[model samples]
Target: MEMTGKCRLLGIVAALATATPVVAADAADVYGAPPIESGWKYQVALDGWFTALDGSIGLRGLPAADVNVSALDAIEHLEGAFAASFQATGDSWLLYSDFMWSKISADADVGPFGGTVGFEQEQVLFTALVGYEVPVNIQNMQLYATGGLRYQHYSVDLSIDPVFFPGINRSGSQSWVDPIVGMALHYDINDRWFVDVMADVGGFGIASDITLQGTATVGYNWTDTISSSFGYRALYTDHSDGGFRYDATQHGLFTRLSFHF
Candidate 1:
């Protein structure tokens, strides 16, 4: 498969919490430390990921094409992108969910007729997980075992302009879901600083042959209910079906602003 061009939209989470300030309270602070209240805690977060794409894609029995697009290179063709996540935490159980959507356009020489090919693609990813805290002796730290489902949808449009034959246009979409299991670790450096790490693996040849993701971030509390973090994240997926194949890795800087209640 001689695939040519591919671009993944990097999300941007605006840290608007600083625009307005709130009094810091000690009773029930969020982010780094555990909640003091006995009731459930809720969190909403926005994220930005400026990633580089490296992978291969094939369609219609064609040879797989190489894809290498940088964040700067994708900016010109990026149409739209959005990403956000939600969380609910209890004494020893938690629920987390995330959603991301992106659209981009690219050009390549993969056309069967030896002409330029235009490719437009839109992708959506949603993930949800339930976790239970694992007991440990360490103080100011927590660990959780997590299980979840990941859903992916792709819509692609292709245009091929051949020298002799009429132009060809095609559009199609595919959707699939995968089962995943992982672990999360959160450690508080102090009253104002913290670190978080998470890793997951999925697929088991059920949907995509295999999928992997990892994230690590360091955050600072701005108030009892607001915080910001910056770190790195990497994700990889491999899947093939009905003459369509996508095996790619996206890795880059990750930023987030979170609100707790």
Candidate 2:
């Protein structure tokens, strides 16, 4: 009997050891939800605001004379944007590819010229990001910073009214590859509700000068599937020609609605 009892105890120990891995795997799957391998997200936004532009225009080699003019002015503004992102996640790392298009239109009156200028800027960015969640007692709060490369295209048109300049139209398109950097703070009210604030800044090519853009937003997530946000954005650009300089500033309020899958 003693021999049989000892064998039974040994058999129980072996069974528990064999079942340990299976139990642990099941617990991990239940507690540590993994990110989807692939998914698509889309967003649309509406924006409105005021803008100010300050720059100097130089006219050289015109009728054997050089003319330099400085302008400081502001305008009423309106804008919109659309964005889509594809996501990839790992145990301790996450990657996202984002494509976004933003447009702004405003009118400014300077000197004897009363005209409207509009700009549309678009970007496709790919980033490999690594993030760590803070070890706070609160659940679902994360802070992350990302740096990557972005390809940007900017289109601008300045139209002078017939009252200002008989028939003068100025328009140009520029594209460049630039470095992008950003930071984000996200808080989850629950599994299906959250808020985020994000900011990004970058510079384009040599001729394009330097540019900075920032935005702040409050948002809500639905069913871990859809999101809607309202926010404000500001942009500044310092552009220079061979002998001329153009400084532009724009600010606006925006609303965004997005779907994630």
Candidate 3:
């Protein structure tokens, strides 16, 4: 476990950089809500997630280690990041897609070894879903049942250089896909305001043992084709393969600006 300390330090970087929020079809519901609109409507959004990471992670068969990093702490190590979402709704059906990517790296002292260890990681997350809107009895409210696939890819590189021992370098990558099912609810409070809530669960051991996500947002319509939302989101994932493991929960405040057509 000579590299455990370095792993823990860099794990914080990985967790924070990977904290992109999950996106849903109802992200812009205030602007394009249902009574089952007949024509096709489309929306594109840019999202920001300020999240904290808490949980354990293991790399290359190393024992699981703890990581708890605040959003502010993660910002220092994040190299690059991006997140975006798109949705199209027709008479009772909707198609939604989201993509997120991040890269992070860190350097730490290797105990008393008089050397430095560096770690870097890059991750990508993507989701696609098709859903059918079901009119509910509640006035000004709509519900949608959705099913989808989530894809994840990760690449990591670790290097250790010590004064007394030979240098060590390791690099590896993994990818997996999971099937998810969920529901979304949108309620219009008035002509200009609305609320949305969504939840989903998946994995079933097909890839990760389990994965869960939830979000709640309050939205405002700026115009017929523009809207904004602010909310809270939480996501959890657990996966292990070939000695690499990632089990963590990411949660925080999120905001989005969306355009509709």
- Top candidate, metric TM-score: 1
List pairs with backbone clashes in candidate 1: 1-63, 1-64, 2-63, 2-65, 3-64, 3-65, 11-48
Across residues 1-261, which tens digit of lDDT does each residue of candidate 3 receive? 869989998999887666632223444464674544468889999987776677766677445655565677556888888989998887788788888887877666766648976767688989898889987889988789999999988786767788888877767788999999998787999999999787889999999999998889999999999999999988899988987888888788878899999
Which runs of model 3 end up more than 4 angstroms from their true locations? Answer: 1-37, 106-119, 158-170
State the weakest 10-residue window (summed lDDT) of model 3: 19-28
Q: Which candidate should be chosen as best, given lDDT against the real structure?
A: 1
Q: Who is ahead in lDDT, 2 or 3?
A: 3
* True-structure lDDT of candidate 1: 0.83
Model 3, position 197, has a per-residue lDDT of: 85
Q: After best superposition, candidate 2 residue 222: deviation in angstroms?
A: 3.1
At residue 200, candidate 2 shows an lDDT of 59
Residues 1-261 of candidate 1: C-alpha lDDT, one tens digit per residue: 223222221111123344333424432354456545588989999988777678876666355667777777566778898999998888899799989898888876755557777777788989999999999999999899999999988887767677788777766677899999999888999999999898899999999999999999999999999999999998899988887788889888889899989
- Poorest lDDT segment (10 consecutive residues) of candidate 1: 4-13
TM-score of 3: 0.76
Count clashing residue pairs in model 2.
Answer: 0
- Point out the higher-scoring one by TM-score: 1 or 2: 1
Clashes of each: 7, 0, 1
